[model samples]
Target: MISAKRIRIEKNQEVSANYVKKKMDFINYLDNDSLAQIFMLLPISERITMKEVCSKWQEACQLAWHDIKKYKCTNTIVRNHKKCILTQRYVEKVLFNCGIYLKELILSLICDSSIMPIIAEHCKNLKTLEFALVEFGNKNTYRFVEAFTQLEQLKVVKIHISGYNFQFRMLNSLPKDINEIHLFFKPNGSPEISFDSGIIKSTLFTTMLFNSDPVAPSFFSLKKFTNLRSLTIHRCIITDIIQEISRKTTLVYLDLEKCKTKKEIFTFNQLLNLEHLNIKDVSFMDIPNLLSGIFNACKNLKHLDAPDFHVDLAEIKMENWVNWRNLVHLNIRWQASDAIIENIIKHCNNLEFINIDELNSESTIELTKLENLNHLDFEVTNIDNEVMVAIINNCKKLKHLVLPEYNMVKASIFYDLSKLQYIESLNLAFSFKLGDSAIIAIAKNCKLLKCLNIKNCNITSSGYIALTGLKNLEELNIEMSVNVEDNFVVKLRGIKSLYCSGCHELTDTGIIQFIKNNPDLEFLNISFNTNVTMDTIIAAEEAVKNRTNDTFLAIKSVDSDIEKACHEASKNRTNDTFLSIKTNDPDLEKACSESQWLIDC
Candidate 1:
């Protein structure tokens, strides 16, 4: 009995509604592969939240989980596992819910013995395992090793034993196919275990022993690893391992940092394939001969960290480094002359990084010829303006320049630095000569600067305003810089970490306003600002709570009389507060200890 015209209008309206709903379903239009790709771009927390949106989103999250391969538990979170059951439960939940298989697992905590069996059962495809600060009972050690042996695909294993009454013989239960083994023994503890030459003779590729007793019996001989490529021994005597190392012809990387060894221990002619050699803190009275022998044989060496001893350049020639064309990184604490720099520039054309103690005018001139140099650490007694200009103008690709403890007297140095367009990080700590003009030049020119450290400089409030031009700056450290007042805090923008400790000119109004503007700032250090009271602390807490994000604010002052007053002010706070207040007052620290908001005071 309805009218035909009315029925026709209703049909049209229904069709329009369906069309609009179809247009709104944008995510449903994407294919499964595209949705999975989008899900992979999200952070872990967002990804977890996405699974509740729809069935399609859940499927995409599953696909994303399949791509994950590594899991790590930090040391601090694991330290609380002994007393906090919630921490242990959270770790277990993350492990079980993420994925079924992981390739690498690194735990820097004391793991429970029962958890290893569960990990072995679920993560059967694991290949690399590392544990630091491990504690195990006498019976649990064997069970832990036995559970690890079930993983047929394991390739690398590293363990640092800190518990007492645990024997090293438990290592014999490890699978024979492991290619790398790193073991560290604590002080005053010795393990009663002997290595059978046949156990590790076939497939070992790398070995490291750290902090072992010097007088302990040799566990094994490295000569058995016919395919060894890297070996590292630290804080132990090398007298017993020298012969075994001499026979490793396939060694490519060797590190003997802080090892007790003499000059005659290194006759490294047999290691023809050696490319990276680190001998830091090793006393070598005959350094010239040792270096000559290494340069003659290891022509393919690419990275070398030589001894801290002095080398007489008069005894060596330019031709000695002629075959070192492949060297790219070098760290030497020795004094060198202009001739040494000239030879290095002429031969090592591919040099990209260098750390040295001294450089003269002529030597700096030679350093300008390195077109591929990206990092330079130069410490000198005096540097003139001309040398600084020449180096900055020539090294166009320089990214990191560190001049700690250098005597820089000229303000023209800032003008020279502004020419470096690609520089990202600059450290001029203890250079008391730099003032407002230098900071302004840096802010105007260095567009890509991300980290700036001008600690203990003569920069004032007027100079600090120039930093507002840096849009990409993420870290700024102006500790001990004088004359910083309220106006200086208003100009900061887009900074994730700000360090302004010892700036006594700062007050409560400036800091509270700064915190409100930068609500997402993660770290703020305003220690020694005596004007900052409990009102500033309350303002910071409010700002962070409104955003629902975690932020750390440090406000330690020399005045201790307000400890009781601050403690009384913070007692009413709840556990839901998102701000962590760090202070030096003992009474306030004890009061904040019960609240979850206090991280470390």
Candidate 2:
């Protein structure tokens, strides 16, 4: 039976091919599965063209496109197609479906002097319409705006007009009901005109706007969008954008990645609903009044990203900001200071993830005390036994850890971590002191360890022997582990995701022998390994494709059905999928493996 995806692929072939070709430069852009999933979303013509790219992509593309199209037809008001080409028949269909319940509608064409009238003649019920170009100079964009007046339910509209610049004065009014609007520029681009002069006028009600122009279309202001929920200003260098945003108290999310701001004293009161804020590549000498304003106004805030800045707060000043109890994620690059951590942990009780790249011994100890902490990402130049003991003793709920270079760590300190049973993800990158004992202690203690990253750890065959006991381990990253050989592969038979990149000591004899036997693996990254070649990936793929049902091969001494079911289920699923299987009655070892190390094993 021809699936819906196959039909859609046949309908949208040309555009899909171009998109795939453009993305081919990225080595990790999209795997076969991800591509298959994406292709299903494309129109039939696009999907068909994508299927022709390679025999391997055909079936997955066909199936995915079919399912998504079929699902959309049942609930959507928009018809699926690759690109918009306004024909008489297409125009008639749009006019007839003017009141149609559409979720998404795409329009693509080289808008020159002729295409705008055709689009205006149809497509009034558009929930989403993507335009390739808004033909300028022809004075046709104004007609397009007039047609949008009837699209009362229009939620999203994206227009790209490169060579033709909009007098925008012509676009006197925008669709007030539209929630999302994206404007793109090609050769000529949108005029760098801001609403500063009040030359352009519009009553278009849009929650978000993506303008390629240096200045925002004066249409966006505090009084313009009372119901605005979120705002994103990309590629624009408008000063005091935050000050303008402060007037919009309803804003919940704001992303200012490349924008710069003066040392303007800004308060967070206006953006009271803000929960997620991202400010990247912007420098500030002092985090002045930032924390206090955020805590006072955005009490419900959850995530904060403030990089390349250190903050020194007085204890009294810290008291006012302690009410930020709702914070769950924090990213700050500060000097290693114990007092700072004590203040931070004391306030944010429910913090789940924290990225403090520079950590000191005193701060690491304080980190161990945050009971609600789940993920800890930091880099340390020097870690002592006392700090290690503090981690195992306090950060009992920690599930992931990213360690710094090994030469900076004392080997004896790891022994203390043998008690942190909850740690499931462990990364020991760039380490020199980590040896067999440390690896063995981890293997023996972290029985529930799922991901172990020991890149460049200088581990040997003995380290492999120690790791073999981690039967439940799913991901093993020993990249650049200079001493790792083929024998290490033999020890990682149960790991579903393995990275042996730069393991110069590995040989084909060892790799091929294991690839033919270990079929449970889902991702194998052996890049930069002199011993491995293209044949290695091919061999791994073949093993995965031809995997046999071997339940008896699974270690069954596992205490609960969850572990048994997961072990058996892994044979048919991806590593990530298999890792998600839950165990309701996990063994004591698995339950205790949260952050504290060895509990049962």
Candidate 3:
């Protein structure tokens, strides 16, 4: 009699399963075309989300989205989409409207003399200028120098020197009233840079350089820039720069990287206004002296990135960490004792960013106390389940989180990460263990994610499909995920930037359709793949060209081919239309010159 009762209970469980099956079957009773018309009445936001309901609903949502794009809607409410993008063309138009009130401008495209007049005449209040030109530079680039001097209010300028002979042009164009200057030279054999101290009229508070190599003898002295508040140099000769730089009461950000002796310790001690210090690139033999000097000088340091300390930890005293109580960002990029890390956590109570390589069990305990950490990046460190859970539970204010790659952690750890509903950026790139369940978990819970990098992960087509629900995701990196197919383009929309460099499954049709779907896409890196051909690239260029419609651009060269090309480009050219390359190939250079007007390209 008991066995008979158990069989009856088992039969009752099957009833619920069969009922769910019957309900699912009922939804497919209507054809997708009919279901799509009903779904089309919903808002675009809801229509995109409905794709994740089930296979049948996903099909209907795909069709509904297509119809919404093809057929214009009479409903004003359905058309209210808040679209925003920042591109070369977008900024050019925006400056025309708001140049007078603009306080900052960042340009990263091939700058022609075409817009220099507008900037010089209207952008009078511009204070900060980031001239991040990655294009091949030539004599025409120097023409902007005259316009730069007109912006008498410009205080900070960062110019990336790409081509030759423009360094002096930068110096002459920059106004004497500039307070901060950062010049980064590209690694393309830039000419020896020289600094004329006589031209500088105002006090330079900040000076930074990147690969400004073989600088003139006068560049190392910096005799005029005596009141530097912060100075940074990368891949340049630091021996003379450190030895000759005069120490002023205002010089605080220099001691950590340049000075390491007992005599220099007193100068650092008085620098109470120290801002940022990084010594990762410097080779240090005296670890104890370096640490002591930093401890003495870094009383008010807000940011510090220290080098590897794989030394005798017993020789160093961990008691000096209390002096770093004001540190807000600390990056210890190597293995250190648990005691030092514990001391850091205990004293650096205001730390908002922490980057460490390896964390032991003891340090993990200390990490749990940093409940307000906003950023964490552990480089290739395997975080166990307990440590991962501790972080997810404690770091409530984390907006950017990077877990360890190639770990043995369970896939369920992603579910823990998804609990961070407020997180804006999450990176799980190169994790062999991350699969469809992790993506599903993020889709179901992590609604506020704006940037997600799953590059070269173990995600499959189902995982890629699950990403359709991430409506707020603006930047996505699924590069090298071979399983990524055209279905993603059919569902995902409004992505401003996408990097699918090695996705072998993507074809021409999907890419062109994607470009059409997301009209505001600013960046796309579909390189290293053959399925996406030049035809799709031409379509992308046409879409951007139709929007920018810049029918005229000035060319200084006397070449007729360039003039003809510019005239044609005025009628058809868009950003990224021509590849700006530094090649020795004569044919390639000739081919790019006609279109780009840059001699090197």
Candidate 4:
């Protein structure tokens, strides 16, 4: 009944509609793995929006959500009350969607404690939880603490309470499955909670308490944790608590920084399994006895940092440490005599790292006998030429060496060290007499050098030229080296971070040349170079804009007047410019905020 032409027109229209549908539904053809990868790249905010795009995108987002391992909820609004309810709801939605696989959650904002149940119901796999509460009171904190009882998988919990006076009763209600706990309480705000040893009996791995109060309540007994491995206590004087803890726990690591305790309170004999011990800021007159006890009992001790112990080395026999073959790292802040150094070398043959307060020529020579010494830090009034040569010849495997700030050995020291091909990091900062010759010798010999610090030295432009031969140089700090000029910038080839602050001889033209040559530079510090002007800033902005790759450049300067000029110049620039200029000038900071370019003044 229909004509042939009309029938053909209807069939053509149907074919065109079919083609349109295929084009619109093309994303459905992608496999779930490919779609999941694409969704994983989206930000949490954007991922939430993609869920509504289509069924395929929703499935992809769900798959991506399973891959998320950590999430944080921080205050995003300027005013606290102005944070609309929608923000909380949106966060809840994210938690409900991604909580299935999240292992860590950090909460810093003010959220209702009722939300804890929702998190527990969703994030069953959560292992680490960190809460930083400042203004929030303990009104609903009980609910937050109670919800964790249901999370059997939670292993670590850190709570930082400040500004508000939180009751300690809630601490007694924590889950028993948590293996590690860190509690930080500001002065005067921490409440006095009674001891409930049963609550923390199962927590037997690690515990850290940093209480600012001078006279904090010893609420809990440490004797309950028989399986405790690591313990750290700060500020609070818990002599009795530590004594009980030492008697009960076979701790492997102990940190008593800034903790005040009687000498008789701690006994190291029971802590035979102790490996790492930090007693920094804890003063003890009878340190020799304490060291003897630790070295004799804790033979497995590997890392010992007792920089603040006021002990007379002459009173203790160095032979006590001779049997500590397992000792690898030792840091002592007290002065040691030549005899003490000789004894340490004779006994501690396996030591790879040593940091001492002072060492003389003889002590330095004795250090060469340790073939395993790779990292050495010592202070000396004068660095003898023979001592430097002795170290270079004996410690050929030296990778890190830090000399005294007061010592200024002659240029020949570098010539001797040039033979040490394994040196990777060399710091000669504050050595006023070190000049270009030393750097030249270093560059020629140490081809593997990666980090060099010559701050406050007497290096000139010629010295920087010597650095040009260092192909592996990554970080260079020449702060206060005023003689270094613009010509040195061109020779910097592979450096990622350059600090030339106080180099007054460097000009704006020189800075632009350096920026152009090193397009991949990430950090550049030319602060205090009075010759730097607006042109240098403009060149940095252009370099970032023209780059094909996504690289960030951070330039630091102290010239307030030039920074203002650069801010004004950037007004017409596009937002795609990724240059960041950090200055301490107030006017420049205000101007930067108004401009489209990223500024951190």
Error of 4 at 250 (Å): 3.6
Worst-scoring 10-residue span by lDDT in model 1:
197-206
Candidate 4's displacement at residue 558, Å, is 4.5
TM-score rank order: 1, 4, 3, 2
lDDT of 2 by residue, 431-512 (tens): 7777788787888888888898888776778877788788788888887777788776765667667777677888767776
Task: State the lDDT of candidate 1 residue by residue for 524-601, as single tens digits.
Answer: 887776776667766776676565333444444334433433565567754354556566666557655654455455
Q: What lDDT, from 0 to 1, does candidate 2 have? A: 0.56
Evaluate residue 368 in candidate 4 and report its C-alpha lDDT on the 0 to 100 scale: 79
- Per-candidate TM equals 0.73, 0.55, 0.62, 0.71
After the best TM-score superposition of candidate 1, give how far the Cα of residue 480 lies from its true spot, in angstroms.
2.2
Candidate 3, 1-601: lDDT as tens digits: 5798899898998998999899987857999988888887875445655666789987776566443211111111111242222244434544554467677766654444466667788688888777654333444455566678799887676666554334333444556556565655443453223233211111111232222233333532444444445454433323334444334446555423322211222224455577666666444333344444556545678777765533233343456556678877776544557666667667878888876565575576567688667787765666777777877888877788787667666778866787787788988888777888878888888888889999999888888888988989888999888899998865778777788888889887897788667655656666666676556644554554444322211111222332334445445544434222233546535644555533432
Candidate 2, residue 533: Cα displacement in angstroms equals 3.8
On lDDT, the candidate that comes out on top is 4
Clashes of 4: 0
How many residue pairs clash per model? Answer: 0, 43, 0, 0
Worst 10-residue stretch by lDDT in candidate 2? 69-78
By summed lDDT, the worst window of 10 consecutive residues in model 4 runs over 197-206
